[model samples]
Target: MTQPPPPPPNQPPDPQGGFGAPTPQQPEPGYGYPQQQQQQQQPTEPGYGYPQGAPPVPQPPVPPQQPPYGYPTQPQQPQQPQQYGYPAQPQQPQPYGGYQQPQQPPYGYPTQPQQPPYGYPTQPQQPYGGYQQPALTPSAPGGGKLSAQLQIVIAAVVAVAVIIGVGIWYAGSGGDGKDDEAKGTGGTTQGATGGGGNGAGGIGGGGKEKPPANTQAKMAFQVPQPKVPDVTDVSGSWITDKAYVKPGVNSIVAYDLDKGTPLWTLPLTGQVCGASRHVSADNKVPILFEATKRVAPRYYQQCTEIGLVDLNTGKLVWSTSITGGSAGDQKARFSEVTLSGTTVAAGGTDGGAAFDLANGNPRWKPQVNDENCYDMGYGGGAGLVAVRKCGPYSSQYVLVQNLNPTTGAPVSQYKMPTGVKYASVVSTKPLVVAADVGETAGDGSGISDFFSLDEKTGKLKAKITADADQYAARCRSTRVEACSQALVGNGRLYVPTEEHEGSSGEYGDETNEVIAFDLTTGRTVPEKADAGDKYTLVPLRMDGGNLIAYKAPPYDKGGQIVSIDGGTMKSTVLLENPADKSVRDAETSFSLNGAELAYEGGRFFLSETLVSKAREGDDRNYLIVSFAAGH
Candidate 1:
């Protein structure tokens, strides 16, 4: 899946005209009381009668040096007669109400120069009262009085502004009284729209409610890692060989998943089969093992024997015969065998066949063309057998067939990719089935592919290709093919791949990794180790859906066990083994229901490595994990 895009940058702020506050208008000219009085006097100068720019002329020179007698002195006596005698000539009375008037000279001033009173104008007074306050006329722009029409216009604008402001306030506040009446079912104002309205079903007013608690269920089997044993050839499933144990021999010993456990100093019985054969389908019954009487080149006589002691009573159960080949045949060997329900199905060097649980009756037989159909597994509601067929001419045929456990009928068969056929079945699921795929016959240098097959049909599902042959070279020089890459689990399939050499020139002897693939979906989880990382894999029995994958430390034999809880799709490391000891690489592993049962390092081991919570009592703790169906 593609990744999502990044987010955008933060938005810029919006602009508002100015600061959004009211501005003070320039004060109207001459508006204040004292300032208006000064304005009224400005008009008076305009109405005054004085002529602009008029200059005064000198009158006839008065007789200066006049004596107190009102006559000129004798030194200026020549002009004194005209000046002193002229004043007494006539004190004529003025026509208007004048107290003393100068001689009315017709040529000197106006002939009828009758003046008004001292502070009045020269003209006779009219009937109108004083000045009439100049009728308050409109003035110019400099220092003018307001006209009547302008005053009316200003008043109308103020009224309109007030009306507009009131209308805006009303609209913003939800349309005034009409809205209030329409929404006043409860006779009160509300802050938000439809706020505190009746809720669904009209039960109570709406408001916030709390979230509910988590109530989901989950699966509980989380498998812890298994303890390492002190042995090599640790491959395939574990078995107790209870079907062939002698009466006087030791019993009930614990061992690791790989090797047979030690009872005091005695070796476990029937553990050294020619093909290393062991089979147990029902956990309730004793384990069945194939004990070849002679070596591979000699007489090939085999028997399917049972332990002398029972699991519950410690008593010997009846031994059953597992007939394989003609007494003269030497190449015949028991490859894979398992008990399904009450019937037992065994695959061998010649062909595949079935046996009855009650009396060992021959059910059916089918031939295998593969030369190396050497391994068998039973779990996923069916039984499977891995084969290496040698076909016509020189073809190396490799295949695995699903068989009817009761009748040995070939239900399904799978043919893996060419040149990638020598493999061991690791684990299978509904969607993806996995197996170890590579050239395991001799010293090879090619890549290994982990094949996943569909459980329903025997078709190829997916492939996880890696280099297992290179990894097995360094794991140990004594390792065999069966014990090389043994891996199995429920949700996971473990495929061991070799790690490539780095620039450090440090060949850590053995560098291997267990590749885990999700079986539900045919995908490799991202949690897998980096390519060429080294590790080992040990698959415990399926408990339910959840399983465990144990991870060993890098460059060290000792490691820790990790429980993989399937429902959560996660793994947690649980047990940490001691660092001093090297792990015993065994080939066998088994599970009784959810528990792991094995025998390695000289003891029989049974452990409930991962158990569910639903079955959690001391009495119910033991689970009989079997890879078989009911009778």
Candidate 2:
């Protein structure tokens, strides 16, 4: 949703400013942490992140979501899952000491009075493992130092903790699954993601877009949202040297990167359901779409077509589909798509298939078997990995397999820990997986720990325990490569901490920071990028060794695109959007959960992936809103 800078250590907490300032919360339970909240369940069979108490309706299996801020300006729809996007699992309110009202959506709900605007804010106390020791903020201005006796007591406690930690590591190495508690050199290594953007030394090298002379951007053009009767999915966006590409109702369209005018449009017979983020060296991507649009009675068309689109030419080079298994003669329908090197792959409940990226040549077809171990999904970036699920629907575990892109065979396989219903692949080469072991992250954020494994050997290197409340990184429960705000590069796993009270200001500001964990040591590095007060930072993607991030604006400001040094965590604003009121309101309206963002060549684009019919009198809904600096 955004980008951020570190503030001075000690400042007064503002009683105002920032979006969605959360009141202090009682420590919450996560993946492996102890539960302090209680709940209830329905008698119906459970599906991944299914609506808790609703009448059952057929839908795709989706991940859970933590509480998300809704659109205040747009008309308020019922608090239900849209036809697209993840579903928020129902949580029963637990009895506390006092009565608690149900949570409210942002639109139409009465907002609390506005507080004064604050400046720089403080860092959030990072949560360690699950214990959540109090993060000691710097003493407020002029605060006195600790006394000598107190210092000595703190030292003794630290010494005892070190000794106990070492004992746990030793005992954990001996098995009994206690190893889950130990820190890890996650993934053991890191490699460049397979696009030309990862130039040597992590520079956005290779004639890639360079920072503009003036980083301030004025309003460019926007793609208006097409009205849809039902919630629709246009969930893909990308950029190249010449154009910005997006998928619309039943076509893939490209627009002039600077002018925002249409470059060309490639028409298709049906709607686009999914697309691969990785663009091949030739500027081609494989997208999954339905064979035809709704034709009444059979309103929901199956996603049965895979078409390779040439971004440079805006043409559909070839299209293909497979048929077998349960569907018999009907083409197989897939829910996911990814790319690695020269191979394009698609996976789903029906089966999985791989095709040559250059031509529609089948490399492999679904094999008949009773193993029940299907490749549920694959992650593509620096490497190709598959999350293979086995056992019956009642009880199933997964295997993370590093696959040969062309052969579809496992080069190395790592067994995920027990009791993990689903695992999200964060990276493939260094091979990191995120999961909520035993459903410990009960708030529906979908992750509590990150497992770093050796991609070549499939051996475990380290396990990183991150509290769901403390970190904002999320990987959709089953969609590999569906991770937002979680970035990996430079041999490190980077994540933004959840927003907290800022360091200084008349009205305390809300802010967050980006921190790195060593991919080899599973230890945190000193590098961190703070989201300055009044804005929030979300990791967009990596630019060579540097990180490309978006700085989500507050009420009065437009968004920003920043480039951060991987080693120093120093952020350079590459593109600062207009601060004008109209533009700022338009830019901030897109929700973080449903928005698709891309920044390249001084152009920053924010688009809504899920759209529905807007009510009369409401501001125009946007499909793609853009800004360009030095264009």
Candidate 3:
């Protein structure tokens, strides 16, 4: 390759004058020989570099020392180079955008040189629409070897940064593919699972837990409606045929006891169905419900008909539409109703009265001065027991009255202590046991007080308190967990009350519970209904014992059902779901023969199948399980 011509005799070739600034003029070219360029001479003054006569140009800041590249860097001087070998002469000052003619150099150097702007590349002269960017070149250092080392270092740093960034991103992405898969399948790799997974797609995550297997031979009954059911009575296995159904405004339906299926659906005819209360003394008769109906056109209409159905067949044994004088008057109501054998007794709003079972015939009617009488009880042998309250809807005391069931004649009357609100007769032969409400002073907690009465006269014989601490002392020989284990038995009552301090530091108070009471001595003892203890099964009832109780299995925070022994009283862990907090109601009872025990709760039925045989042994315990078909 031919080398480029050298600079002219009077010119210098350095292009490092901070770029973009004007340079001295170029020299003329020679034929066959290298052209020459005229160079501006540096003035002798300090911090100045320019020829004797030239246009002024701005210079860079005063550097600490002269830069290594020998180039003009002065700002104030106006010096210009003369033609080669020629004497200095005055010349016209050039305008900012004007160019001067080239002058010949005295000796060896190229002419017509150009300088580039600071941090910019020089461009070839071409006709174009706009500026074209120069190709980018890698930056180089002062020395060749050092520049190569710097390049190597930068490449390494960049590589390392990219690697680190990728690693951080991967870590922050959370679960791996396998983890996600596991979550999708409810934390398992099982096939076709539906629900939130353990990681991302858990099978049971968002899906509801699988219900327990239903294995009972007898099918369990369902509420006629899936909403809050109006529970009337537990009369002989929950028969739900239409005959037993009370027409409700919402088309209410009850369930059948044997098949656990919905019974008859009665068109409520736009009236709210009432709930049944309890079973009669014979255990075969059920005291069903009665409510008034409000017909349309007028805002209110008096209800006259009372329905009495056979427990077994749901057959309408009797229905009586009572007639009160006025249409809007509510006093034409059948306030309370009950049954004895084939006879149905009803208390009317006008006065106390009883009706016949075979037909809507009045058996007897009695006079009651008080208008707002609420509840009535009966003793065997055709005598009436009523609870009468006084004051503006405030029940201060309970009035116990006995009337002739056949004639509805007043027999006798007695008043209980203050604050006696609710009462139920436990027996009615020679002696009668009744439950009444009482409240203590400390927490004003209400207690169920049991009382024994003389059947011959309407008189209170004895009162018993179901003190928890007292029952706990009696059961000290055995494992005692809670005070509520006491239960009432034939002609006797059992109850347990505990004195516990309030968790809020308001002073520990006892829960005075009344499970049962003894009529003869007026003493209360804890029976087995109190299963609130941590985990200790207390037998709720024994065979042939009037009182029976059972505890449902303990579950985790979640309400997954599980099987638990009624007698074990031991706590076991079941499904735990912290999100749901619902109160569970459990009822335990002995089989009709008392050979086995059963428990009922929300969609759960538990039974001790071998309890009768087991009770013969010292163990007296049997496996408890959820009833498969009956639940």
Candidate 4:
């Protein structure tokens, strides 16, 4: 037998395994079909199973068929084999013009039709003239490996997108975009770990325990006196670093707290009737009412001057003179003046006046009705001036109004309780109105009621009633009658009281007590008095949750400073002032020569006037002392 010849170039090999076997009929042109094989020639050389010079077997001729549409008559050139095996069978042109492998088996074995890979097409594919297949990517078990540079770029893009999203969220959430440290005043600095330190002081009646009392006199300084004679009254405001002194009948001077140096002095051309400190954010000034005596034939006349002097520079900012009859008759001479923000309001029995603080121009004329008398003053922390109008008869109602700080217009107005003749504002933040509630007794003593109003709407919050006899007595000794001896702190009002003696004609038989009332519920706090404590505990102010009180003597003598716990009512002496001969001599000559206590920041201040024995004729000097420990 002879070996088979190789197939013609550009033609496919037979799919059938038999020698010189006829192939099946193919489909017409343009239809998808496998390429046909050409006739093979006999082998010239001998093969392993065949001898030489064997007769050649004739192959049957294939019928002529037209070529597929759009294809040339000649067959295409065969491509190189992808793998080392028998010559590859010609493939049909795919629909996208890519080639597909033939459906044929290896030599000598029965031919079995090929199946496409799973998920691929089983039928023959058609030609698609300009289409190309995408190249397959090399991959591992999971997926293809990415380049290092591409991975870094993807991570950077994702991180940037996250940062942008976070930035947008933070801006929408009320971030002020300022450093936290730059937003505070730094005034109330607290201690490191202690609970009852400066800034650690809580409000609303809840706070930490009081610290141990180590209030020995830490230091002392003197506020120098003006050389003028007849120094009538001296008062101090610890909110500012200055003290006010009224010397003689016409001069008011302000002195520095640290060095006893005079800062400014206001000399009135007329006799000074009354003066007060008007505190504002931009400037602190003294408001004065002065009366100049004008002598006319047979009758004496007088004119009043209302003036404001800058405390820092001693400059007379503004002054206006009003003839006695034009301003408020004789009542204008004694009108109460109060400062709230940039408005200055003066109200009296006759009328009232509101002035702009910037230039002292009149904002509005005083409202005076013949049947009612009005009194105006500061409303404390609510940034308002209270105008209280009382009727002529005690049976009529009293009207109260809280005026706007800048406009002097009534923001809220309400009538006093029945049978109340007078109402005055005591505190402003938790607005407290103090008024005489009922008729006086035979001894001229009465009951005073304190009503706490809502700061914004002036609605009543709480009401507490207290005895007015001791309050009246305490106010009579002070220069300013409107100054509330009752201290408001830690959500309680601490009022000084005295037990009235029976009808036995005994003046020195009264015992003093300080009562604390809760502002929220208007109930008395259940606290016991300090054991064996005889002296009156007069509360001046609150330091944290503790009360800074003065132990007043029964007679006109010296006193000591003490700290009273708000929760326990325990008393601890902070300063001890002996009633020696020198102090008694000073008190005998100068009635105002006693210890005055003030506290600011974290330090305690005490101002005392001592008689100068070296000088003649009632000469006195002032001494200011400070006490600061664990501040």
Top model number, TM-score = 2
Candidate 2 wrongly placed segments (more than 4 Å): 1-158, 164-210, 296-298, 505-508
What TM-score quantifies how close candidate 2 is to the native fold?
0.72
Could you tell me the C-alpha RMSD of candidate 1 in Å? 52.3
lDDT agreement with native, every candidate: 0.30, 0.62, 0.29, 0.41
lDDT of 1 by residue, 587-613 (tens): 112121222333221222333322223
Candidate 3 residue-wise lDDT, 430-514, digit = tens: 3343332332211211223344555444334444432212332121000001112333334344333332221222221111222
User: Candidate 4: how many backbone clashes?
Assistant: 5
The predictions' CA RMSDs to the true structure, in order, are 52.3, 17.0, 46.6, 45.8
lDDT of 3 at 420: 44
lDDT of 2 by residue, 330-415 (tens): 67778889999988888766656778888888776544344344556678877888776654555555667677776665566555
Error of 3 at 90 (Å): 99
Q: What TM-score goes with each of the models?
A: 0.40, 0.72, 0.41, 0.52
Q: Which wins on lDDT, candidate 3 or candidate 4?
A: 4
